[model samples]
Target: MRGQTQTASAGGRWRGDGAAAWCWWWVAVVLLLGHLPSCARAGLLESNPGLAYNFYKNSCPSVDSIVRSVTWAQVAANPALPARLLRLHFHDCFVKGCDASILLDTAQSEKTAAPNLSVGGYEVIDAIKAQLERACPGVVSCADIVALAARDAVSYQFKASLWQVETGRRDGTVSLASNTGALPSPFAGFAGLLQSFSDRGLNLTDLVALSGAHTIGVASCSSVTPRLYQGNASSVDPLLDSAYARTLMSSCPNPSPASATVALDGGTPFRFDSGYYTRVQQRQGTLASDAALAQNAAAAQMVADLTNPIKFYAAFSMSMKKMGRVDVLTGANGQIRKQCRQVNTS
Candidate 1:
């Protein structure tokens, strides 16, 4: 039987040795395609770049929420802290793409309250660093982490589907306390905001677009009362509807700094949309920064442009990209923090 089998295999159909050789050759090809060029594929999925992005995508929301919550607490802890964070958000986004440099208190002013003010999200970033270190240490930059955090907070609060921004920005090591004037004041008229954003190399379109941020957050009566009471005229031009304004005044009151500001859209404050523009058209914009946009020739055009959802959506994304590019503090210049409210507490 063995002789017959050997004869058949050698002479015709069953060439076991030949079949084995073919199998090994195909296996080699498969292995090469799957595993070759480790360096070239290093940044691909399962590689460092992929992993870093995944880390940001997965980790950003919790980190952002934690950081934001801490900031709120800090604000609660001290009246100055919330104002600083709000101002920081305004300054950072307006200047260098919201890099949080406006929140830092450096050597410039030890005595000046405004300059020395810092609502440190760096501490939150530091905590994130330690945790990420436990999982994949030294792979993520604090800039990227915080940028993702900010974006996540916006997306989450607005109830938009996850809006992921590009990461990989390095944390800034130094702080600039003197640049606080860069942000627009809640009291500033349309022209003031336009000029401030323009100085930062941003356009009136950006000023209008970013003002939509007021949709999701609450404001103090001290900030909005002027508009509710008599109207800034230059800012709240045409004036808000008397009935609506009166209703708003009832809720906000006069003189109380702690009274809450009304939402711009009145409904769905958390959703990012063109409703903000529509509200401005209706004189329903709540903040001076928001209502003021409609008074400018350039910003008015932007507000009109945003009345079209398609255009507003497109312009909003572009504006966000531009806003994110403002004065980013990066590279050996920033510190990775263990907490969001303090500088490197860990």
Candidate 2:
């Protein structure tokens, strides 16, 4: 009986020891997991993997649909809107990442810059924000909204071509006109354009691809006059189609501080097609920057390659995705302002 009791006690002790050992093993696992990279965790508690696709999947299910709805309405009302909104996003990202810094209303802001002066569509963004705030206040960041609006507007323009956007971006508090001096200018040469894109984490391919945005926008005479009056001696920047030059000079006989508006794509200005690539290849590119692509040996190949609708569309989508990532602040690192035009009072 004594031996049996002792045996039973030993069995119980062994069982307890085994259970404790298992508990300790789990604790070790928890501790190790706690130290993994921020993205490895699965919660909104932190912004690991920084921005993600459909980040508002659970928090705000209607976010994307809402953006598309608002964008489509604006575009429907004004077919010119997609280009304007797309330009707004590009200008925003170039200045200080896609932080909605461009959306901020302030004296002496980036909006004061010459390139940004013509950028419209502020009311559209405001309208979208107002609706989002109504649906899910503080759940979506203005930065993410701007990024999505750009994607949605482009997808709306090019229904056959689309790409996913990674969210989680936080709004920035700073917007300055002075910081934009480094941005690629209409007057930039290939070297300057290459550097400008590189500074913002883009490449030669990206430069040509994103320039496709010009396919649907208008270029002022001021942007084109130089290519004629002050243009390359090699017959209108050597890349411009001769007949197009005559047509441009006819409209822009004299340089105005702001020249007459002409479509970047000579004939099909409103269409978001590979027509811009075709123009560049024919030396009919409107801006010095667009024509410069043909001037660069390597970029010329990309220019030629993108002339194919399939290639240009794919490359353009990829480049836009890459551009969205410039100097972004993700996760809890930045604030989500109630108003995109102003930082939170806190």
Candidate 2 error regions (>4 Å): 1-49, 158-161, 231-238, 257-259
Give each model a TM-score: 0.62, 0.82
Q: Rate the local accuracy (lDDT) of all candidates.
A: 0.51, 0.76
lDDT of 2 by residue, 1-346 (tens): 0001122124354344545434433443454345344423533224234778888999889998898999877765666676788888898888888888888888888888887877887888899999999999987888888878877776654332255678988998988888778678898899999999999878888899999988877767777787877634334655667888888787666554463677788866766768898888888888889888998899999988888766666566667777888888886677988998888988
How much does each candidate deviate from the true structure in C-alpha RMSD?
20.1, 20.7
For model 2, how many clashes?
3
lDDT of 2: 0.76
Query: On a 0 to 100 scale, what is the lDDT of residue 103 in model 2?
Result: 84
Error of 1 at 301 (Å): 2.7
Best by lDDT: 2
